[model samples]
Target: MQYINFLPCEWNNDHGFTQEIFAIAIKNNIGIGNPDTVPYRKSQMKNSYQFLHKYKADINTITIAVQEPDYTYTNPKTSKKFTQAELYDFDKNYIGANIIFWNIQQPQFDSVLKFFANN
Candidate 1:
């Protein structure tokens, strides 16, 4: 089974935990996720893509999750209790090499394993 560590872009600048996760993945020969890169605008996406691509990792194993902009549900009357569908449409439109949806609630671990097992 392949394991891809999901790393948010916000944590890229602060590589404390991110680096640790990356190190573990590298040591184990697992994959890594670059979700933050997909959210970048046109100009920024290029650099983000470059940075991730330079890792020389297996692109097919990478995953990216994008949240929807209007994915919010508040209480009917009170301003309490709410949930948002963090996976956005753009998240599904990533053209990066081997990018797949890494839904926050439903990660691809089980599905990916099942796919490979079935194959």
Candidate 2:
């Protein structure tokens, strides 16, 4: 499944996250966490929630402000251009790295919002 990463930045509260990502999860009825949110919220929510170490299955999956070709991207770390399918596959399989989408145009952004909002 194609997903628009609403949780783009981690740790910094000034980043356009926390609220947006939580809103998305609330809307989608899905749960999410990250390097930043995990530590920050875990302590506060410990009494009511349980924290799990299931992130090895998915490392850092953040979308850059830009998108590459066909709304796809080139792996900044590898300088390799991977198709959407390939990228998602890489995300699932690669356990020790990060994937960033570069040069994203508005259309791609729209498609992402549509997928997230309507799906």
Candidate 3:
């Protein structure tokens, strides 16, 4: 099966937009209703930089990633053209953030990830 886009219907356009999204993370989650205000012991917090470095992963470390936008694709349903660029986001805290804003329309590189309404 082809990948289905989960973007909202209203977001359909010639190009896409950027926004903040919450991603699912697996870890221990102490109950919030615990009577104790400071419930379970506080686990050591690892900032974005710490997490990325722990896996020996960095944006610039990848060679097959998109570093420029040299092509564009059209939306089948809307016939609206959109730029096709592959990107992987790294935490801002990560010192080796090698983000490249391929398309000029895209805003300056940041920690947020961009997705198209039409996959």
Candidate 4:
């Protein structure tokens, strides 16, 4: 199944004007929640893991992934490009924070494993 970011902007061009079209697209495709919305994506991850644990044991894996945006903001009027380093510093703390968050969410990952082990 194809996957798309659940962005309202994309729905207009790809799924038509109405939300019914958007819902149809979601039903047809593998609609991963938007990365920009952390809580929504996190919930999606939990639900997906649970589903995989129940039905797709071979494919289920604990994935603690973090994706920083590829491009920095560019000034449209000035035609100036801002490098990632210039926009935001990538440092140890950034890595540490994600690690901490991943650790905090380990129980959810563990549940998937426990489900598999029991069955």
Candidate 5:
């Protein structure tokens, strides 16, 4: 059987929901679903990747959903938004580290489930 780890941005606030989803996904052999609402600094993303790798999780099997440039913020000090180029650049740089990108605006849940089913 396959197992998928679903991580939500609000996991800290909704542990029960998180656990429920994780359990269901694991039992069904589906893909993990991670929210794109939370901002993940480059360092944090790298550290997370490292931690997962350390735990023997296949990097290729992991995917991170991210908001579109219009919805993503530039920084805490300013209300500026990130450009598409910047977002692509960040993903490109991190892609080699074994992270796949998914646009949250799309029907990611179904798409991910299908992806896992096919793979």
Candidate 6:
């Protein structure tokens, strides 16, 4: 199955419907955790991990954003250059890394690394 976005059109603070949809998608083998959203909303993040653990989503296929490159990207195919804001938007909407392979920067990722090294 392909990827699915569980973020609802209406963010009315109700997540029950979205949760059900995610369950269905997981049951059908849809890839989870790709294309994380902007601002990385806390609710979405929580739900994604919960479902990922609950459904035992394939660990190898899962992805998460690792870094915030401070540069513009030129599309090789069309030769169209993307502004930094556009790049950030794309990263938030389309790019990701596996939990194990996420190329994140300091602080948050530092904590994760430290925890693993200590334990």
Best by TM-score: 6
lDDT of 6: 0.45
Off by over 4 Å in 4: 10-104
Which tens-of-lDDT digit does each residue in 19-111 have in candidate 6?
676666656655555444333334544545445444543333544443443223354444665333443444433333234233366544565
Best by lDDT: 6
Q: Who is ahead in TM-score, 2 or 4?
A: 2
In the predicted model 1, the residue pairs found to clash are 66-88, 67-86, 67-88, 68-88
TM-score each candidate: 0.35, 0.24, 0.17, 0.22, 0.34, 0.37
Candidate 2: where is the Cα deviation over 4 Å? 1-12, 15-17, 20-72, 90-119
- Residue-level lDDT tens digits of model 1 in 10-85: 3333555544554566577675564442333433344334334445453335555433321233334445422222
The 10-residue segment with the lowest total lDDT in model 3: 30-39
The lDDT of each candidate is 0.41, 0.36, 0.24, 0.30, 0.42, 0.45
Give lDDT tens digits, candidate 5, residues 18-74.
Answer: 445444554555544333323345443433322333332433343444555424466
Ranked by TM-score, the better of candidates 1 and 2 is 1
Positional deviation of residue 104's Cα in model 4 after best superposition, in angstroms: 9.8
Clashing pairs in 3: none
- Residue-level lDDT of model 2, residues 1-119, one tens digit each, is 12323333443334645445444554555534322111113332231112112232332333222233433434445566544444344333332224344334665566555544754
Whole-model alpha-carbon lDDT for candidate 1: 0.41
How would the candidate models be sorted by TM-score, starting from the highest? Answer: 6, 1, 5, 2, 4, 3
User: What is candidate 3's lDDT per residue for 5-73, written digit by digit as tens?
Assistant: 223432322122211110111122211110111101122112222222342231223111222232333
- Model 6 error, position 28 (Å): 1.7
Off by over 4 Å in 5: 1-33, 37-58, 68-70, 75-79, 95-119
Clashes of 4: 0
Q: Where does the lowest 10-residue lDDT sum fall in candidate 6?
A: 92-101
